[model samples]
Target: MDGSSTTTALVKAARAGDGDAMDRLYRRFAPVVHGILLSRVQAADADDLTQDVFETALQRLHELREDAAFPGWISRIARRAALDAWRRRAPFTGEIPEAASPADSVESHRDAEQALAAIRSLPEAYRETLVLRLVEGLTGPEIAERTGLTPGSVRVNLHRGMAQLRERLGLREHER
Candidate 1:
């Protein structure tokens, strides 16, 4: 079966109280949800908000009219959760917090953080798309599938967002 058909089956099973199906759904879509949250909230909060979004989706699964609409529906939940989180967020100081694990090289961690910040600085459409494509490591088609964007729109967003990100990072076209 095709991917969407498989996803629809999983959603149907999940709605029927199948725990394994729910687990599989979570595994498949968690990155999309997390990327959505990251587009609107701090990275540190995105993980927790991702969980919250899924919990909310699961609780309201019966309200979802179409099984195939799961990706877009869950994405809307993630956006709402991220907005709520942003509303409740503590005021940011100028200081950037270190989020590196011990195994990560300091320079690489810093560079990653800087790149993420640049991505976040983009317009909302570009920001979310880029985060899904870049940070979440989703392909253009996968991003389009998960976010309900047309393939053309995803391609345009990726192109423009990359250009803006490169400008923000002072990188030439050849550098990438």
Candidate 2:
């Protein structure tokens, strides 16, 4: 009748080894995972890693703590896989070189290495949440749903992550 129930039924079917159920589950959640990878990884690599996340989720679904918790469980795996991808991008860490930029203009020459360096410097938990929202472009609720955390936990991570990002960027927090 409703999407929630439909999702539950689909997950149940998938858990039972139904090929169609697995297909339906993939159709429902693939875009969300793809979008997250697209935001957090290079476009060239996102598609491949997105596939990996789903494959990992499918294999690990039986380990999920709850049926309704599928989104969060898969999200956490995606986050970990994305983080590993980030770490593997370069041999050393410093300012993301200008080469990673798409253009050569002085202004357009934003350094990806630098930005990622900043993001990586954050506490692990906060960094993951920030990337999901800012880089992955997932909403707080979407993140909560995927990560198996509460909406409030996602919000707290966002708030704290922003504060940390601001500090890392050398800006003083503005008191409103």
Candidate 3:
């Protein structure tokens, strides 16, 4: 069967309590979810939240109204999980990661700072779409499938986000 058909079968079986199908689903979507979480969350937190997302999807799979849209349902769950992780995080202004080398870390540190600042500055829709596209490496259709966005919406978000990123970086041209 083709990939789409395989995914449909997996979703149906997973909803029917097939452990192997659930495992397949986990393998299929975990990277997409993890990529979305990595930008706004710490890697460790992203890992934990990824598990929570899949577990939640598995437990609630029976409630899914459309098996063909399982990826979008799971994406919504992952986004919510990441946002929750951010809300629970303590406010801090210093470097997010511990630094061992002061002189050697300047460039790397600045890059991180710039990325975080750019992400925070974008509108909510733009930010999520950017992270999913840029960091998660998801295609427009994949993101649309996962996030329940129309493909056109994804394109608009990506365009707006690239414009904002270019503005933030003082670049003459947009990049996505």
Candidate 4:
């Protein structure tokens, strides 16, 4: 069977209380949920929230009307988990100053950590799209396919996200 059919079978088996099928589902989608949470929260928080997302998904799996919609559904749960964590962190929002850069300018030029921080600061649509593509290694088409977003929307998000990342990184438009 193909991926969809396999997922459908797993969903059905899981819904019927098959523990192995549920484990399979968790193994298959944990990375997707982790990537989604990592885009919005700290790495440690993302790891915790990824587990929360899957736990909630499993608890409510029978309520999922459509088996094929699991990806988008779990992604929504992951986002909600991040939001919940944010609410728990603080009731108010304030900016934190950036830390001092390293002395070695050459090494700093390709600072992936800084780039990831900038990506997290982007608007939700762009941040999620970019993280799904760049960090999670999903292609534009796969992103659209999994997230239930239109191809055009995915393309636009990627384009705008890249533009914002370039500007934030102090790269010229032509350099992109």
Task: Spell out the clash pairs found in candidate 2.
Answer: 71-146, 72-146, 72-147, 72-148, 96-113, 96-114
Between candidates 1 and 4, name the one with more favorable TM-score: 1
Computed on alpha carbons, the lDDT of every model, listed in order, comes to: 0.85, 0.71, 0.77, 0.80
For model 4, residues 1-61, the per-residue Cα lDDT tens digits are: 8666777889899999899998998877777788788787766677788888888998999
Per-residue CA lDDT of candidate 3, range 11-55, in tens? Answer: 998877799998987877887788676656766687789999998
lDDT-sorted candidate list, best first: 1, 4, 3, 2
Off by over 4 Å in 4: 90-110, 173-176
Worst 10 residues of 2 by lDDT: 91-100
Off by over 4 Å in 2: 1-6, 16-47, 63-65, 79-106, 109-112, 173-176
Estimated TM-score for each candidate: 0.90, 0.67, 0.79, 0.79
Q: Model 3 segments beyond 4 Å from truth? A: 1-5, 92-105, 174-176
User: Could you tell which candidate, 3 or 4, scores higher by TM-score?
Assistant: 4
Candidate 1, 56-170: lDDT as tens digits: 9899999999999998899899988887887888733322356436677778777877887788789988999999988899999988877778889999999999889999999
Question: By lDDT, is 1 or 2 better?
Answer: 1
Candidate 1 stretches with Cα past 4 Å from truth are 91-99
* Residue pair clashes in candidate 1: none
lDDT of 3: 0.77
| CA shift of 71, model 2, Å | 2.5
| Cα shift from native, residue 90, model 2 (Å) | 5.8
